[model samples]
Target: MMSISSRFAVGIHILSLIEFNKDGISSSEYLAESVNTNPALIRKIIGMLKKAGLVEVHPGIAGTKLARQLSDITLLDVYKAVNVVQKHELFSVHENSNIKCVVGRNIQDTIIPILSTAQSALEKVLENVTIEDIVKDITEKENLDKRHS
Candidate 1:
């Protein structure tokens, strides 16, 4: 089975870091350190987020910022911004099945609705969850960890 791209998680990480360090720089290099990846990859994902209007990137500047408030940005927004799925499809049906076989001919038709319904359900959950929600969860978890420490 195919899995979602890592870009989606990295995109969220970038936004969360921007919010956490609002007063400081959020350059690709800084984000790369946190993500444990290369600056070029971070920049590529940031460019996608900027094009989606989720972030504002200033040329020759040392940092980037959120284009909208955290409450207004949802997981779905970041998912689309980073092109996590091609053509918004979470599942891909196998092609070139032999039409001579009954199962091959009917399989695509039989599973399309199920896949569509599943995708819709997943998207609904994503839509309801905003970046603010994630940040709050992170803050709570961090506080809990500190208490334990």
Candidate 2:
């Protein structure tokens, strides 16, 4: 099964770090450290987020920040920011299916609709989850764990 690209998660991690450290400018190096990745990869993800209007990078300061309020940024928005999959389609159908095989001949017709529906379902879930929701959940879980400890 095709998986959602890691770029999406990295983009979210970058945004979360920026949100958590709103007082400080987020440089590519800083983001890379937080993500345990190289600066180039972080910058690439930052470029995608910038293009999606989810992040803003300052040339003079050489730093980045979230462009909008956390509550306004949905997971779907982040998903689109870094995901290159066509139309946010999660599944890649096997190409070069044998025409002579009945299953192969009808697979596209039979599977495309199901895949589309699955994608829609995922989109719906993502649409409901904003960055604020994620941050709050993380904070709450951490607090709960702290109390337990």
Candidate 3:
């Protein structure tokens, strides 16, 4: 089964960290450390987020922050920002299907609609969830864990 790209998760993680530290600057190096990845990767994702109007970068300080309120940004927004895969095309159909075979010839046409429908369903769920929602959940869970400990 095809899984959502890691860029989607990374974008969300970057945004979450920015939201959590709105008062402070979030440099690519800082974000990279938090994500345990290369700073270049964080910068690339930041560029995408900036293009999508989800984030703004400060060149002088080499840092970034959300362009809008956390409540206004959805997972779908982040998903689109850094995702290299074609939009709404989560499933890739085999291109080498033989035209002579009945199933092979019709496979692309037959499966595309189903995959499109599934992608749409997933997008709808993502649209309902905002960055604020994620941050709130994370904060609650951390607090609960602390209380237990």
The best candidate in terms of TM-score: 1
lDDT of 1 at 33: 96
Instruction: Report lDDT (CA) for all predictions.
Output: 0.93, 0.87, 0.89
Q: Which is the winner by lDDT between candidate 2 and candidate 3?
A: 3
Candidate 3 yields a Cα-based lDDT of 0.89
Q: Give one digit per residue, the lDDT tens place, for model 1 in 1-149.
A: 66899999999999999999999999999999999999999999999999999999989998999999999999999988999886536788898899999999899999988998889888889999999999999999999999999
TM-score, cand. 1 vs. native = 0.90
The segments of candidate 1 whose C-alpha lies over 4 angstroms from its true place after superposition are: 98-105
User: Model 2: residues >4 Å from true position, as ranges?
Assistant: 95-106
Which run of 10 residues does model 1 get worst, by summed lDDT? 84-93
For candidate 3, list the clashing residue pairs, or say none: none
**Per-model TM against the reference:** 0.90, 0.85, 0.86
Top candidate on lDDT is 1
lDDT at 3 for candidate 1? 83
- The TM-score that candidate 2 achieves is 0.85
- List, residue by residue over 69-141, the lDDT tens digit for candidate 3: 9999999898888865577567777798999999989999888999999989988999999999999999999
Worst 10 residues of 2 by lDDT: 83-92
For every candidate in turn, the CA RMSD to the true structure comes to: 1.7, 2.3, 2.1
